[model samples]
Target: MENSAGIVKPQYVTFRDDFSFESGRVISSVTCCYETYGKLSEDKSNAVLVCHALTGSAHAAGFHRADEQKPGWWDSMIGPGKTFDTNKYFVICSNFLGSCFGTTGPSSVDPSTGKRYGIRFPVASVKDMVKLQKRLIDHLGIEKLLAVAGGSMGGMQVLEWGATYPDMMKTLIPIATTHAITPMAIAFNSIARFSITKDPRWNKGDYYEGEFPVDGLAIARMAGHITYLSDPAFNDKFGRRYSAFEGFYDFNGFFEVENYLRYNGYKFTEVFDANTYLYVLKAMDIFDLSYGRGSLSDAVELIKADTLLISVSSDFLFPPYLTEEIYDIMKYQGKKAFWYNIQSNYGHDAFLLEFEELDRLIREFFADRGL
Candidate 1:
């Protein structure tokens, strides 16, 4: 099958000697895969690191020189004169350490046993991903970033930048995200994980030696996909529509919407590994900026960047209220901050699909700052 876009073979960098997760197992050498776009300015001030959402990879923009089939993940926003404007800024995106796309994870070979780590692989955390990203930036000779931006899981990393490396960025843009995940969010993820574990082939995450648990993973993806869209979106797109060109005994599929989700799950399984999904989701679940905070507001105060928080009005996954809270916290701390509630019916995925609004805002936001 052909890759979606801008997919580049990336270079890997090791972070810890034996990186482990909260699950208490240490694995040797966690590797991260990343890609870079444009050139670092003479002073290296034009660097912008774009993080991808859950299930996204390092391919942020530009087609690989030898492979046109795989383009960058954010090609819509990251080319020459695009919102990210690679012509003016050096854009970097990387797969987190525990991901499947060329990065070390459960699917990667265990150096000790010469077998896939599978469930034996150490768990990863959001902090670990951020720390490894900093190493990637340093390796590129970028002392600081013009901006750190992304949506969803990527936005979580952006928030971490302000909290963990506040002085490293000139500006921060976190879209469609929250300072900390909600219990509902945890419940959804827990259910998805349960779907995978309940599969007989999961075999305690040791399915590497047997058939892949595609059915379970696909069901999990189907369930989660529902949360990514708004009720209005579903009503408009599918509502009570039934399957086309098929009767009651039809085998083509169920409703058009069911077919849609099935397709989404099917295509996703082609390029994404189930084990990697388990690892990454676990990382996201453990993400909570309030861990060190007396309150969420206190957690926001830890950020040290000129920040811009954007949220989609219809996004239930990480609602606009979360963005408002972050903005309020920053303002309470007397920091330079801005926010926008972009109206969209597309819900959480709005930040990715509703590009015209996002692209315009990002370009204007940076241009006004002379970035």
Candidate 2:
């Protein structure tokens, strides 16, 4: 499949009769589309899975072979000699099950009825997404991985992997994320969901073939974008800069910051589907590492591998407090774990922005393992 950008769509396999979720619905099948970089070593232990963020796709660190215009989101950190050096590790990045980019989601046609699932797609959780990932790894014949690393929503998945399959990874990195959704995070996500559901065009989420809820989705993105940056950072970026237009006679605000946010919202709509965004955000809100276990320490004991917990000092969404809690628990449980709280004004998005230090840290970590 070719996207509008002319990128050659990734090849994928649909696993029928995969595992069911705690919600009691057996997802009849799961289709996972992924992109691979570097060559798999003979032992297959060099594999590293890079899970994408909430609105991201399987494309992680390079431009598609078919299109050079759009490079992967983490292009800065994954290269020949970068943090996740493709030169030494076979990297796999997959579009999560509930994503819109070539993977089955609300926009996908329901195989049973030959129509889109839309709102009817089974409610997916972080666990369900992790299960689909397991199938994808099994299909790729990778029995073990060097690491499973990601940030934000991706970080949530990394934690889930450690909980769900503790023995599969040699190292784990979950950055700028939480062990579970906090009340404050839930409040933000709830408002975002409300924006989408309140749109007239949402049509009970059956808007696949009709006009989309662009305005609502745009508003949602705009709202979430606020959490991605700190107030000081935003002030430095825009402050009181006026909009480019001369005299503001229009209803749109005259502040340059307003214009920037509007641009972000509009651009997001063009590349993302509204329904998928809702589903993924909902999944993130529902993720809680402390769900089944009585204590967070008990949960950390379940992880049977060396873990590196990375957090940003200024992040408010998944605050450093959560990462600190996980770190403390891992130590209490006698797990080999290291913690790093990067100092930056970038806030929650620091993990994606602060690369210089990240590069140094990752290099040292991998070298210590003789990679």
Candidate 3:
């Protein structure tokens, strides 16, 4: 059914054939959950794929119902007359292969064992996610995409799309993402993994039948939430503020930021699975465009699509320099590329928060492309 905005609700497609993984494991079946906006043009040339970041779902815009409380994550930059202009482009967003939001993941049942895959779920890479998306796009009968865009982990998938299926898309936009996972990112992921594993209830990622490792998962989400914000952003938003109900010397209720983190953490555990978090973060930790390529330039030179790289000045996690590095490589190789550094205090999440700037850049880019 269509919402009040005339956009269809999220849909699901199950690929029942055995799917091979990069790790050499094969899954008997796979399912992809997705949402689409707009109609395919008569020439089938107006398709756009919006990849979601870590923990994001396929609901990229519009509400499922008239009274829904919130729209999709990138609602501000999509829909009629927006950055992606759903009125003109057929937009698709799918839950990643290793995600738990109605996609095949650790929580999926293993056909061989007839039980939840749990820790047995084959580990996936950014490339794996794109491959599955390619399948989904093909299933939708689109042979090529007009543009592919995303940020953070989603951006990683965008780059993978350019490299793995260089001829599949016309334009690519990667925001706040690096060609490779940095050491600092690995460190943060390690701590998050440790937090989950150390929780006694984790039981080696097999807690589906019993109590979940909610405490550890919450802590992990809290740690990740910090990296998404800049120090200045934190200072501006919280900055030594104390909770209103704090008593004399309470350890847990010391700072307002702590309370905010705790609240978010608790909320996360309610919707997310701990095993899926571990698997997806592990994938992020090992992402590298140059993994088997001779060099960074070699890998980037494989991109056939025109590229746009967007970075945030305050994004310490995937700093602006990282995006600049990719741009430098592409420029040296004489590839068509553009770079924009958004001046914002939102840090890694600036791509999501700086909607006005992003909207302007995207609109201008598409205009220049005559789309």
lDDT of 2 by residue, 1-371 (tens): 11122233477888877558757877677788888777789878899998888998888766677437767777777767668776788888889878899878888998889999898887788888888888899998999999998999999999989988998999888999988878988888888899999999999998887999999999999989989988877988899888857566666547888888889998999999888989999899888886887677777778987888888887988889999999988887888888898888898888888998777777777788776
Once fitted onto the true fold, the runs of candidate 1 whose alpha carbons sit more than 4 angstroms away are: 1-9, 15-26, 65-70, 244-253
**How many clashes (backbone N, Cα, C below 3 Å) per candidate?**
8, 0, 0
lDDT string for model 3 (73-153, tens) is 898877887788877999999999999999999998877888889998989988889989999999988888999999999
> What is each predicted model's overall lDDT from 0 to 1?
0.82, 0.84, 0.90
Off by over 4 Å in 3: 1-7
Q: On a 0 to 100 scale, what is the lDDT of residue 124 in model 2?
A: 81
Clashing pairs in 2: none
Candidate 2: worst-modelled 10 consecutive residues by lDDT: 1-10
- CA RMSD of each candidate after superposition: 3.0, 3.2, 1.7
lDDT (Cα, tens digit) per residue for candidate 1, span 120-238: 77777777778778878887788889999999999999998888888899899999998777788888888889988898988887887788888878887887898799998899889
